[model samples]
Target: MSHKPTTVAELGEFTVLIDVRSPAEFALDHIPGAINCPVLDDEERRVVGTTYVQVSAFEARKIGGAMVARNIARHLDEQFRDKPRDWRPLVYCWRGGMRSGSFVNWLRLVGWDAQQLKGGYKAWRAHVIEQIAQRAPALDLRVLCGPTGSAKTRVLQALAAQGEQVLDLEDLAAHRGSVLGAVPGRPQPSQKAFETQLAHRLAALDPARRVWVEAESRRIGRITVPEPLLQRLRESPVVEIAAPPDARLAYLLRDYAWLGDDRPALADKLDGLRELLPRDVLAQWREWALAGALAPLFEALMARHYDPLYARSQGRHLAGLPNAHRVASDDLSDAGIQSLAGHIASLP
Candidate 1:
């Protein structure tokens, strides 16, 4: 008699899907490639949850179960409608509990190759921790460290386009690594979610080949770097990119043009500097913002704060870490980053 592949580990590499849930829930943490197809949206889930607590279990189950069934049916009819007949999709709810079990059973009945993740997202998270904490240190690392607006992300993008090995921490984290780093029109995931995504992305890369990454502090907005990878970053060599003031300013404007008319966000991000600056300096900062003198505001902010902070941080970190070759952005053409990348790759 033939047996079906029941366990997630037994499935090997397969498409993963997280059952429908809120963006916040998914952002807080989720399995990699597990697109959220919640059995109930936020409002519906909240309603069901309230019923479960305030009303009788029988009543809650009746209402919640029907809602979940409706959601699953909608998911099949709309989202999974165009999926190929042979497509294998793994579905899981929070803990491979009742919600996911019901969906899985329904999928099987409908003749789709559907299976529930044994322990659901929790199991996948444990897998991520084990893989990153235990397995990542074994790989060769190339850290790309630079001040804000140094075009590190662009460099990484160029490298990938040229078939070089690269891992985008910022891309995976959905942050730009600064007070103003949040992408316009896009919301970043929670820090925990970022680490989960990072582990999954890192796991897929060639560990023997050097992986290129931008240098980031312990925290990027709400997310902190994972301990294992953070340790690796601390030990890795730094590739400092130098640029002129004008170049840097141009890069900043170019990078953040999406903020177009959102002067308030700009003001709010800069306003956080009040505590950092002296009274007079703070007044001057406010004046610049009020006067629409963005260039001067940015320049002063970078010089007085960011540059000094980075210098000190690098100085401290450099005491224990070796320096890799430095690349001047002005000196390097569009191809210069690649040349620099090649040189870094050649290092022992």
Candidate 2:
């Protein structure tokens, strides 16, 4: 029946992590495996907030307390009804304030070993950032280098499937790290959420082992890779996937077939590169996109944009890229990618 707050480092598999923030707050970011059981839902929180600001403090507490009590009761009945007496759940709120403390108090009264998270979600976020800063420098990160359309992600997936340790940043970021990198329909998570997920993933791996990751700049879409981790990635040795231009083009055409179905969206994405390319050049790309000339457009982008960008970036930033151990292949098919992965995995 102790009410001590548990530190983030003290987290274990046996204890459940419950987030008692509003649904909107939880949506922005929470602990990696936390379940949302908000003490005050979105509207209730807003109403209580407005009351606190405009009405008397006593009035807001009276209103919020009643709402919190009712919500806590609902959760106890619907969510925690079947829990065993010994079940330990770590509960948190925005800043480990009254909301989570109230819920933890209720659960403790129920004779369960429920504890409040020390400093709540904010503390957890700080811990994640610190962990990355401390951990990234010591890891043996192996970068998989390739230009755009090189299918580095797919090959990295193959390498992962072959039982290699991989850190798939693009998958975590929900982006391909390009102007047109957004996955259709699936939106990216907030930057905090992305970093939390990355830190959690990194925590699970043995940093002593060689961790395979795709080469990327510090930024991916709207999300930026944590600077400490990005520094390690930039400094890592590279294993280049030297696929021919034709193979890369063919692979991109198949992989990005959806872009062909939505020409308007494709054209808009092209417009993002306006500052880099001339207006006339962009106009031609727009024309190519609208006419569904996606293949030629893909080639034009690779030749005029992605390839040159990769060349400069690698030469300037990637210390291990020039002497990268090359795995040359003319095949960009799934099986071919698998073969490339196997070869890379077998490297000393």
Candidate 3:
């Protein structure tokens, strides 16, 4: 008998996972580590769908089948040629319908252990959503609250190194959770992809142990935190890290100095602040950016813009913050951050 379709729980048993959806569909969201091996290119999938609606299902199937066969053959020749006979691959399409079924059937015919994902990508997506909802509420979350440049993220890393559970949400979102938080040359993941990544991390965590996370606004760059997880974060016990203005300014200069290299990009980002700051202040900041005087510019931004904004936002949103365990450091050096992490980890 031929192998049957497998459940999502069995995903780990397979050595290779293939997603046979069109490029556009796969780009929107996919299972982590699954390779795209589309049975239909984006244009061809569109053409087949149009033909099915306007012309005839029979005609569409005929054209689509031929295209799928050619594409699969090409994939086998170029991508899968060296696969060992014992290789086990799991395949899925949009709904585990024709696309993945056809691919699995062919792979099995060639004497490979191939299985289809029972409900395909849609099933996996539903699983992700369900897992996040179920697991987030059960986490022993500890929110790390601080003003900008307090080195909260660095502290989270230090905690992780010390074997404490930490969820770096900003890293998952590919952003630093600020107006200028974007990492150069690294675009943020799609919102769906971000959630999938978050869900995976949440699943790996031990719910009974405390999980450290940085405090963030609802949105990070283009991605929004899922409500279930965000709710837990908001209500968690808080650890507030405080530092002197000079210490924070120095840290900001070291951490974000790369922004000074691209004066045009830095100036463009500064434009977003015009409505909030005085016109003269905004112009001066821009002038400093263009002139590459980053240290003074950073100091001014910390004192004037970020510090005041952080105070207001913390008071308004983080009601639990007032009762937080406070850790004050005048130095944000590696030793200081690690020491802070040690103190946080020792918290009950």
Candidate 4:
């Protein structure tokens, strides 16, 4: 109990982070690298909360205390039985109050250094927001701009391979940032979790070197870019990769070919364009998708749907993009991308 509270700065490779919050809470978001060893499981937490509000705090504690003790004992027997004496760990709950404090006391009695996060997950969330706000504005960010299917993400991967700092927001969010952006089986993280992931990546980047990121709208799938980072990105210098319509379409066929495998899924996603295009145009695209005519349909989409949206978004949000230095390619092939990446790496 005498162990002082801890901050993120003091955590090390060996420091174990235990999130004592309920599993449901942890799923929405928790500190990165933290493990869930809840003192109260989801249903038990609900029952205890109902008791506190409807019955009384005393009765709730009387009921919850037993559950907490049993769960703690189980953890002690299973998760902590092999721990050495010098093991120091950080434990946190939503507010660093009852849940984490109770767990800390038990660990202290067992002779391990168990420090509570000063203000728990709430504090950690505040830290993420603050760090992004404070550091984002100062970033030497270079936005890689191109219309859809221009292989911007590929270029970014190449840049990273060449040891340049790169941030792939789509990769962090686990989505491609479009109507058809969802990966076939993988789902995007909760907004909070996505932000937490983004914050962690941002923290690791050095501000001195140019950090490259793809140009994206504020919303990527369901993940909203942090405001500070988005603002800085919008204002940063742009480097557009200009691929021909045929090259982009060829690239789209390769990239989005999976959509043709599930006609229903493709049909459903194409339905998202209903408001944007004429019914006849939408019908033709839907027909093409259902009929497995991917190349023609993808071409139509770029010409009618994606290209126009990209143009407007670039003009409205990325003010400097009209004069952005262009990197043209007749091909978006592996070699072409590598060449483009090499040219970009030489930029001042």
Candidate 5:
């Protein structure tokens, strides 16, 4: 029985859409729910890419065609060896190109109900752009603005725990939104992966509810927010959480004390600040560095850099806010978070 190609959206809820792009391409971006099942492994994709760029198109096709066939044969022997006869698979590649199309053809020939995404990942990307762009404009957005170490993430978590709608943009991007925000030893995903993650998270939310999110610039590392999301955030309500300088300093010290123990890592992370800080300030920070007074230096660093940026973002956001509130909680303890949640819940 010849198998027909299926639109990914048409794949019944149980159908699995497999991504056959190389790991690098897939990492940059892919459909939200798709799993990586490369028909051409990393090295083979590289070889094919190079051949297409350097050698004749005919030669590249000949080599790529054979390699893809071999990969399919191996899958039948190993990974797909036990796949049930009724297993329905939807496959796609970059732009629904030849790699996925070829695999889909092979799977269909083998008598399973296999199909390919009509436009592959390209179609998925378009869908994301359209939804985020048009729908976000009408959202009741809430921007969670606060200084560094003010427990913004903690506040967001508590809100979610209490059944309030919240979006952890940093978590979605697998980033922390500051030089010190990087999780220990975890590499960030590619920009495409970040968007895919963001879109999936957004799609799962009910647009009728207010979406609470941490205040962030358009960019986190190399990943930039899509235009639609940025536009929506621009007009959202801004709530600033104020803390005394000492309180902010203490908070930062507690959150980032581990980085202080490693001077080399600290210096590397601070390298970007050289252009912004004066040599004297840098020397002062270094003196604190040598004396292991990192907590104080970190406080000074916040006042000098992070605080200013936060203030500027707040200024632009405040003007557009239909309702802005200032919360004077520095530590944001359990009671404080619960109180804040109650306040937000009461809002119309």
Candidate 6:
């Protein structure tokens, strides 16, 4: 029997979840733990679509069906050879159409219980978007506000260590939320993937308990925070952590030491600020990067660029900033972050 699951909740019952969309489609986003078993390779999908539009629907179907069958045979021989007869799998494609239907039908014929998601990946994506829209407003969000290099992310980690519910958005987005915020050797997730991650994280929290998150602009790298969640963050009461310039510089130096190791990459990132800063200033910054004089460069960046930008942006976006609870720390060491976390957790 083939099960047709209309909603993502029903997908939880399956032991295995498979996305039968093209690899390109699966790379964009799918269910969190779903494995990709593309029914059609990227090139084949494009060929089929072109054939469908230019030749005939029947011709396209004939070609696509043969390709899907060959791929399914390979999957059975390689990916599923060891599976028991009783193994159950849930499969989906872009629209729960022929792609997943063909896969599920074949699996059922092979003596396994197989189900097709009723509306497929499209349905799951819609559910995620809806979840964010519905649950974001209900969350008890505490926005953590501070200028660059204030160790806001570190403080969030410390808070989580104490069992606080914290939404580490940068972790989810795979970005630090700045031009130079890219993590070393870590590529950011596709926008849809980021949204799926955000939806799942937000879903696991208790609305009754407070949730802490760093204050971020609407955009984080190539991904944008969903508007409803962004609105909640902007409206939420803030806990502002203020650290001295020297302390902030030290934290930046220690935390971003990786940038020093890649002087060319660092120089390239600085070059992106060409429009914002004078060419002469950018050249000087690049010189410091190449010379490994990061401390002085970081000090100048904070004082001249990031600090002023943060002040103006926070004032404009965080309308509730005036009432924000302020906590000052002279050190951003682990102990200092833990202390700040304790203070934030104790807030009324």
Candidate 3 or 4, higher lDDT? 3
How should the candidates be ordered by TM-score, best one leading?
Answer: 4, 6, 2, 3, 5, 1
TM-score of each: 0.83, 0.96, 0.94, 0.97, 0.90, 0.96
Across 238-277, the per-residue lDDT of candidate 1 in tens digits comes to 6777766667767676666665456666766776777778
CA deviation > 4 Å runs, candidate 5: 1-3, 11-14, 321-323, 333-348
Q: Lowest summed lDDT over 10 consecutive residues: which window, candidate 1?
A: 1-10
Backbone collision count in every prediction? 4, 0, 0, 0, 1, 0
- Give the clashing pairs for model 6: none
Candidate 6 clashes: the total is 0
What's model 5's TM-score? 0.90
- Which portions of model 3 miss their true places by more than 4 Å? 53-56
Q: RMSD, each candidate, Å?
A: 3.4, 1.4, 1.7, 1.4, 2.4, 1.4
lDDT per residue (tens digit) for residues 198-286 in model 6? 99998899999999999999999888999999999999999899899999998999999998898888888998789999889999999
Which candidate do you rate higher for TM-score, 2 or 6?
6
RMSD of 3: 1.7
- Residues 2-111, candidate 5: write the lDDT tens digits: 45555656745436778898887777787767788777888998898899999988988999899998887877687777788888888888887798988888887877
Where does candidate 6 have its weakest 10-residue lDDT segment? 1-10
Looking at model 1, residue 326 earns an lDDT score of 72
Residue pairs in candidate 4 whose N, alpha carbon or C atoms collide under 3 angstroms: none
Model 5: residue 90 alpha-carbon error in angstroms: 0.2
